[model samples]
Target: MNNFYKNYSGIILLLGGIILGSIAGLVFGKDVVALKPIGDIFLNLLFTAVIPLVFFSVASAIAGISKTNKLSRMMGIMVIVFLATVLISAFLTIMAVRLFPIHEQLQALKITEKIEDKPLADQLTQLFTTDEFYQLLSRRSMLAMIIFSVLIGFATLRAREKASGFVRFLNEGNEVFKHVFILIMKLGPIGLGAYFAYQVGVFGPQLFGAYAKSLGLYYGFGIFYFFALFSVYAFVAGGIRGFKRYWANNIIPSATAIGTCSSIANIPANLNAAKKIGVPDYITNVTIPLGATLHKDGSSISSIVKMAVVFALFGRDFNSADAILLALGMTVLVSIVEGGIPNGGYVGELLFISAYGFPPEALPPAMIIGTLVDPLATLLNSTGDTVAAMLVARFSEGKNWMDVKEAA
Candidate 1:
């Protein structure tokens, strides 16, 4: 029974939640108001473990790196790969949005009045102001949290003899936190059910139609965009044959992430897939774990795409300069600066919107759009991580394409 549950639990929970939520929504559509608190509670519970979990995981993982030089090299490659993928995703999303504009009969969708765009300097000032800065960090802002975690981790590593006992304690604590996280994740079905039920009850079927057309387009575009990006990494690391085999082995992890919409929860599967694809244990253990935190191709793409969608909704055309700048800037910013901190997506989205001067009312709609695309985003992010792991393995093994092919 334990083995059976381990094998099929995610699928059962996800489908069951969707089906039950749909039924409950149909029956209690008018009473969604009552379900709001339940959904909120689930979200609160889900996020409650994020901070401690991240702090320990990151600190331990970094401190556990045996050597500073190897750690730096691994991180360097990871950063480069992360940035490249993000840029490609962002560019593809921008093009797709332009070609398949979300609003065709733009006149139908009400355009909220534009807010005054904040200057970059002012926004930076606000971002760094002591109170605001503390709030961002306290809230587990992914970017800030990551920065703090990395600093502490590095400091702990340098402390070496002085902090050996403390580091050991943190490593143990990280493991304990992971166990707690696993326990919480097992309750995902209930939380998803409650959240979905609330959404259905509050909005009814009418809400589906509201952004159905735009969402459909975005989903289709995202699918194409992801495949294109995946292909590039596969080809660079290995040829078509290698790529096919690599992808086949990775399907389980990719599929799980898509269904669960949580990369962290899918880490075990991802690690397994990496090893299956011949990625070394060292590379897989380190890169895959870290990638789960920092490499969010899906989130980055969706953010840029949503920005374009918002622009279209407001009947504003993004000229080439604006489009290129937004895509490149967002990709670079998200890849390097955005830490795999808890609730990083929401924080990044809010900051993006505020910086661009998008209307306040636009946030709700943007969030709604994000929910629909989040699964795909998770898929892209997980897939990208696998690909990066493959690259790292290739480089570390000192194997060329010919060598890889011959080995296969």
Candidate 2:
């Protein structure tokens, strides 16, 4: 029963939200716009907690690492896997979008533009200059935050005794922030309902149908993309049997993520899944929590694919240089920097458009599109977490689980 609840809670919430949203739209209709501020308040509450939560959690995790070499190896493997997963997911999504082609003949939606324009040269300069560069690297901007967190974690280790007190404080702070995050998550369904209603009320449900086929295609591709990448990683690290066991245990986390469309909210379920899969507490404590914030396979895929679609929408043929730059830029910004925050991907997409000097009017439509797609992406992201945790556990145990299974 406990396992069933975990596995199905997300589906229940998602279905509930949709039902409620549709009812709200039918009744209140245009008046649903009034709910915008309430939804915004919830989003603000979630966002307000992100920066501190990230800093403390990362710092404490780093401080807890007892051996520099072990930490380095773990981090090396984590980064490589993260990037590779993201790139593969992105490549597949791009292909799906091209082949399936959502809204091929539909006119672009006109909405209030939130993007800021700059000359192409200026945009390039912004991407490279020291101040802007640091923003991306440090993740003070969405793209820089992950880089900054990793650096701070490593630096805390170097600080050793000098930073011990600070590290302890960070740990304490992480606990407090976690409590706050929980409080916000409890209100998520309501927030989602309100936001969805407001969106439908303002734009009308017809808008979704305008690209309904595309949206459906996106979701379908996202599901396949997740399983394909995770299957390979699981087989490589955990063997087929271990992989099967891992998935069996992780159903709840995957369901919860799909329902809530928030990876952070799925942390408890993920940790529980990790424990059930026989991962060490230290590994689960460190990786699951960190993964909630930094590992965003689903969001990375969506961001990259969306960017490609956006370019195609504008009838701009992407040259090799353009595609490479955009992919690298997105890999840094979407996958790493904005990995953990609630609605982080939506904000990152806006920044991507702004930084690229795309028309500001594109933002509102992008937001609308991204919001609709986020839940599906979040599900994929959570599934990736399970796959990653299993792999990490296999590697850390210093046994070739995959080979053992093969021999069996």
Candidate 3:
């Protein structure tokens, strides 16, 4: 009972809050909006930590990589695999959007237009911030911060001894914030509950009705892609019997991912699943960790879907050849910085705004769809990590990967 509560308390609280909040909404109508402040406070608390959390997490992730030659080869192969999968995933997403286009029903709802147009050169320059401190203070450019953190991490790797102290400090800083972040996550029940209550209370069922097609399409496509692509990869690597064995071993990581909705949080489970599936310790240790931070096939797919939907709603020509190509490339590039994205795909929404110039008004429904399907995305992400590790092991170490597999 204790363990069950421990595991499910957040879901329980969220459901309770929503139920009660909805009742209040129905009974009291707009008066129920008084509860909005509770959710706002919680969101503010989480947002407070976003900048530092992203900065330290990215920096520490890079700094943790050792300056070893073999590991370098492993990282290179891992990246190649990661990009290969991302490119394929992105293309699939674009194609899916083009095929099952969302209808023009949402055109009735007027959306806010709050985008600032800039010259191509100026837009390009904005990606890299000029003043680090100013950027940090303003919280304006997450890409710039991510870029800087990665550089610092690489520098520490190259100047091992000279920068050892600084690296240690960064590691310590990350740990401290990580603990704080965990504590903040403990407030999920109250935060998400209040937020959902306010949302459902105000918008009613029509809110969900608005995004039904987009959500349905994303989830449906995600499942198909995961099974289809993962099955193919497993079959290629280990044949029929091996494919069955691989999926059998990967059940735990897949479940952990859906439960936690976080790839980074599923590291231990992924590592365990990797071991069960016979990924070497060396490969799992480096590749799984890095993959969690970098690989975001699930997020990429959802982002593309959201972008396509938003573009269509705003009367943009999303199906044009140039638009499709830009969307594909942007998915890959935005995915690289996905680590900095806040939960519920908020940062991803910003990426759409910046990359494709989608209107800010269209963000709410897109976010709603992203939040609804996050579990599916995380499931793909977590399971994909383990699969990627297997691929990395097979590619880096040759086809004898499963020879070391323990017999069933």
Instruction: Write model 3 residue lDDT over 149-185, tens digit each, in one string.
Output: 7887887877888888888888898778766766775
Reference-based lDDT, each prediction: 0.63, 0.64, 0.70
The local lDDT score (0 to 100) that residue 163 gets in candidate 1 is 90
Off by over 4 Å in 3: 1-5, 11-48, 108-113, 117-122, 129-133, 179-205, 240-242, 259-265, 308-367, 400-408
lDDT of 2 by residue, 154-246 (tens): 888888889888788877987898677667756656766677677667656654554465567777877776667677777776677666877
Worst 10 residues of 3 by lDDT: 103-112
Candidate number with the higher lDDT (2 or 3): 3
Ranked by lDDT, top first: 3, 2, 1
Candidate 3, position 142, lDDT: 53
Candidate 2 clashing pairs? 113-360, 113-361, 136-144, 138-144, 139-144, 139-145
lDDT of 2 at 320: 47
> In candidate 1, what are the lDDT values of residues 1-408, reduced to their tens digit?
575465446546655875587578878885755765665555555456655666676677677666657566766776677777777777777777677666544442343464443455554444334345455444324435555667888899888889999899888987787667667656655665666666566556543544676677667877876677677777677667548757788778877775556667778888888777777676788888778777778777777766765565555555457545755675554543333322235434544554455544344445556655666777777777888887766656655733553577
**Residue 120 lDDT (model 2):** 54
